[model samples]
Target: MDIYSKAIKVFGKETQLIKAVEELSELQKEICKFLISRTGNVEEEIADVKIMIRQLEKVFDKEIIQKWEEEKIKRLSKVCEVVECAKKN
Candidate 1:
C-alpha cells in the first residue's frame, strides 16, 4: 500500500493525528524509495531504516520538540551561542 492508504489505516478520521501521520507516512515513503532505489536493501540496513521510521512516528510529539529545544538552548548557552528566540509578533 502507498502512503495515503497507510495513513488512513493508521489514522482513520480527519484529526490532528491524521495530518501528522500523513506527513510522517509521506516522509517514510520517500526514505524507503531512496534507500531501495539507491543502495538496494541489506537485512541489517533495513532494520536501521525501521528504527528511523519509528522515530519519524514520534516527530510530531510536542513534548519531544520541547525537550529538544530545551537541550539545544542549554548547550548553546554554555557555548555562548545563544541568539534571540524567534518572536511571535
Candidate 2:
C-alpha cells in the first residue's frame, strides 16, 4: 500500500475526511487571499489539498470518482465549445 493508504488506514476514515475538509478550506482561504492581495501560499495549499484528495480517492470508490470527473470534463468541453463559437461570431 502507498503512504496515503497507510495514513488512511492508521488514521481512520472520519479523521481523514475531516482533514480533507480542513485542507480544502485552507486552499479556499489561500485562493481568496491571492485574489484580493495578490499574495498567499496558494501553491502550497493546493499541494496539501491534492494530497488530501488522493487520500480521499483511496478511501472512497475511485472508479465512481473518475466517472464523475469524466462527466464534468465533458460538460466543461461543451461549455468551452459554446464560448469559442461565440467568440468567432
Best by lDDT: 2
Query: Which 10 residues in a row give candidate 1 its minimum summed lDDT?
Result: 80-89
Consecutive 10-residue window with the lowest summed lDDT within model 2: 5-14
Residue 28, candidate 1: C-alpha displacement in angstroms: 0.7
**lDDT, candidate 1, residue 8?**
47
Which digits, one per residue and each the tens of the lDDT, describe model 2 over residues 46-70? Answer: 9999999999999899999999999
Name the lDDT value of residue 40 in candidate 1. 34
Off by over 4 Å in 1: 1-14, 39-64, 72-89
Q: What digit string (tens of lDDT, one per residue) describes model 1 on residues 1-89?
A: 76644554576535535455555566566668777786433554556555444444554565787799799999988666434433322
